[model samples]
Target: MAIFRKPGRSGQPKPTPEPTPGQVAEELAELVEELEEPTAGGPADGGPSRQVVEYEAEYRAERGRRRGATLVASIAKLIGAGSRSAAKGAAYGGRAMADQLMQAAPRIPVRNLATLRAQHPTAADADRLAALLITGASRASAALGAGVGAAAMLPVPPAMAVEIAAETLAVAAVEIKLIAELHEVYGVRAQGNVTQRASAYVAAWANRRGIDPTLLVKPAGLAAMALGAEVRQQVRKRLTRSTLRRLPSLIPLMVGAGIGATVNRRDTRKVGRQVRDDLRSRRPAAAAYWSAAAPALPGETAP
Candidate 1:
């Protein structure tokens, strides 16, 4: 057996391999290591940043403010310009209409008109009646033509113009009838005495309000006559039991005059403001002079 040992090498088995100490230590270090850096183009804190969003919101707000300011300034300028133009147009139109009415006055019969005081005979009754007629007529005419011309300035449909014209004429007719009847009940004549009295009242009121009284008188008279007729009809219904049918005759005149005073006052103020603005725009350096001197002019502060 000892002699044959060297010859048994062919039956030997292979040994199993074991890990080295250095290899084991390297693996342990890798398992316990912390991340060294973030991935490319990724956020360091791992969430979306708000810098871009905040910047965009701020930019939008600033832009909106600028646009709003521009719009407001434009609107203000347009309104100011329109106001001046409207006032000039209204003045011209009023004068033209008054002249037309005056020319026609001579042909109108005056002696048969009724008076307003026959039914409500009180202090200053005649004056009160005249006041009512003037005021009411002025309001009616002005209202009827309020924005008609303004529409023409715009690019409106053709049909709208016809409609507006027809409506205005209808309203004017009604107002004239009312004024006539009110005068009739008061025993005032439509053509002469009542017209003169009403004109005087209107002139006085216009003087106080700084407007051209002449511009308002005739139109107002026409409107009063129209409204007076309607008022008379209504009074007829209410006064059936009493002796008040005559009351309708005066109501239109009295109401008209009162309304005229109010409208004149308001419109005068509006015109003055526009005039001031126009003057300022045209001559900024002369604004102070105009303000102090204009009111002292004949018709500026007459009323």
Candidate 2:
């Protein structure tokens, strides 16, 4: 009986043609050269293969900037405007603090679903990614106000108080990024451009809850959010709470710094986890949209 190979749809696998002596040496030399060359990712199935660049470096740089700004702002927050009316101290302080947040908000690099899925291919991985951000930001936030309170008490100028405010703003930005990215991870894309989306995120921060998608849209398609009386009241209340929470960071010396950092880290994790739980319940809808646009979430259940 003679052995034979079957012809599959693509035909029989090609039988290796024995190489000539010269061809063998050429192939061997090419193989040596290939092995010696620096290795890098080649095209896979015609798609460009690239790894997600972890943002740790950028995060560090931004944290350093925040720490410096916090020091400067600390003085301003305490002394208030030198030439302004004494009656204006409270109002001016509030306005200046708000201004810090306004500046920091846009600087937050809230990765969208595409970037997230590229970096974190699974739900579990995404969770770790969020956790990493929270932890890193918490450390930075803790560092921002460290010893500044004690520094304020010294013969130094009024800038130290504002540093506390700056630390709070920086921490808020970090948490806001975590919140917004969590929304993206869960498949919910907030309406409008970056600013509008950020406003919605700020609302979530104000409320400490996940956004209601229906409310993300408004009749005035161009308007980001009305911030009507009720919304204003809500934001005011949230800010008040935040201010109260920040009091401890003003503690001077190593003790205050330790407490401030601990509180910030704990609170941030609590907020992140709470928002994640809320989003998880409402994930399927957004997951469907994202699944169509990107990869599926690991272990995502059917809608």
Best by TM-score: 2
What is the C-alpha local distance difference test score of each model? 0.30, 0.54
Q: Where does candidate 1 stray beyond 4 Å?
A: 1-123, 147-153, 185-303
Per-residue C-alpha lDDT of model 2 across residues 165-283, encoded as one tens digit per residue: 54555566667777887887677657776666766776787678887667555534313363344544565566556656767765554466556656766777788888887777774
Q: Residue 216 error for model 2, in Å? A: 3.7
Prediction 2 TM-score vs. true: 0.61
lDDT for each residue of candidate 1 in 1-303, tens digit (9 for 90 to 100):
022333335775433223332332232122111111111232455644566545654554343223322222222222232345344422323233333233322222222222233222331433353344443333333332322322233343333323232222222222333333333323322232545444422322222221122323355654454335443343233222111111111123235323322333344334333322322233222224212322123444421
List candidate 2 segments past 4 Å from native: 1-96, 99-107, 120-126, 147-157, 217-226, 286-303
Q: TM-scores across all candidates?
A: 0.23, 0.61
Worst 10 residues of 1 by lDDT: 30-39
